[model samples]
Target: MNKKRRLALAIGAGVAPLLVVTMPVSSASAHGYISSPPSRQAQCAAGTVECGPIKWEPQSVEGPKGLTSCSGGNSQFADLDDDSKGWKVTPVGSSTSFNWRLTARHATSTWQYFVGGNKIAEFNDNGATPGSTVTHQVNFGGLSGKQKVLAVWNIADTANAFYACVDVNIGG
Candidate 1:
């Protein structure tokens, strides 16, 4: 090979890996999931809830906001949208802490919780990346009985939001 060609090949090999490392992919990757309260995805991961593809990758439940479907708006995990799936309800009071098992920590914009289509709690992350695990205390207000809670983790840098649908019984 020519000297110029050999030099170009060597430089290309070194720079390619750096480019890949520096560039973050925009696609969704497994990051955060509500583990303590056993969110729909968590229950699937734990085998307590028999789900489709979601059983393999629970933390990958992510999608943009404005869409009110479970499974983070991903049709692949549409099983989570099924209310008849017999999701186990975690007994909780008016106030309870929601724990997040973060695998790939990202700067967060906010965390929100909604029940019966009404927002019960919302907290700002202040554009900070959370720890490996994050716990947010949420007040359910006057809500009672079995209810479906939608938890959202809005990414600060991107337009995507990781979602976790938690089923809970407000009182014992």
Candidate 2:
């Protein structure tokens, strides 16, 4: 090839690959954590449910709405996790339900969620109001009849004082 043509080809080959590699692609979920705790009067505190301030990991903030924080109490929410503390399941013919609670003295204080290690939900609580026990429900109608699904609550707004339970319903 001509001298000019050969030089142009060599430079193009090296530069083209670098440009492509540097370009960013869209991902399913963004890497983020709680920037700041949810609004004090927002859903973070449901009907008299006093969850208290969540415990942000300082790293798990930029996640989603409910997440952004982790629970910092010592109840059921403290025992369940994605790796070891598996979820407690209640099966039903048409559907199912699960229930657990958090005391008031655990780890970080905030609210977050994970289904089988994958984040699926989150929440924040001030634990100031008084109400009935917290009840969370999950629908399994989308999965097959026999599937092992785990649910995790990543508390993120209080100290060490809270608990939680997961209820699943399938077929119904």
Candidate 3:
């Protein structure tokens, strides 16, 4: 090859590798989880509780809507379903706030809070997009002591929903 051709080829080879390395990888588009009154995944992320893969990906416990599990039915995060995992329970009053930290905000349908088999609170967004942070005041009427609260974030345009479980000591 000529000198000019060899120089161009060498530069092309160097730039090709960088272009490939900088390319974005496909990942889940929706990411949000309870932060305050830290959810199981949050606890795992914070190292407050020793956990499995969830420790690395606390906001990725996503599954189909209407499922009732801390891990969002994701087997990789099934450790969140283990009640004996010694999750730190946050103490709260009768009515308290639950906060969420969103990494990728998507159009939301509703935010639901459930205790036991019954849904205690729900806030509908009507397909509106939310900010990076969201908070809701939930009243735990007639409920007391240690309780596991399941929070679901239903995406407006998809069948999937993000799930988080918050262990709280109400009236403690």
Error of 2 at 146 (Å): 3.2
lDDT of 1 by residue, 12-131 (tens): 998887776554332224588999889998999889979987877788888986556678889999999999999999999988999999888999999988887788899898899899
Off by over 4 Å in 1: 1-29
Better of 2 and 3 by TM-score: 3
> 17-74, model 3: which lDDT tens digit per residue?
7765554221324498999999999999899999987877677888999999999999
List ranges where model 2 is wrong by over 4 Å.
1-89, 93-97, 105-113, 120-132, 157-172
Ranking by lDDT: 3, 1, 2
Q: Residue by residue across 77-162, what tens digits does model 2's lDDT show?
A: 33222222232333445333333222222233334444444544444554333222344344443453433333333334432222
Q: Rate the local accuracy (lDDT) of all candidates.
A: 0.86, 0.33, 0.91
Give me the displacement of residue 24 in model 1, in angstroms: 19
Q: All candidates' TM-scores?
A: 0.82, 0.30, 0.84
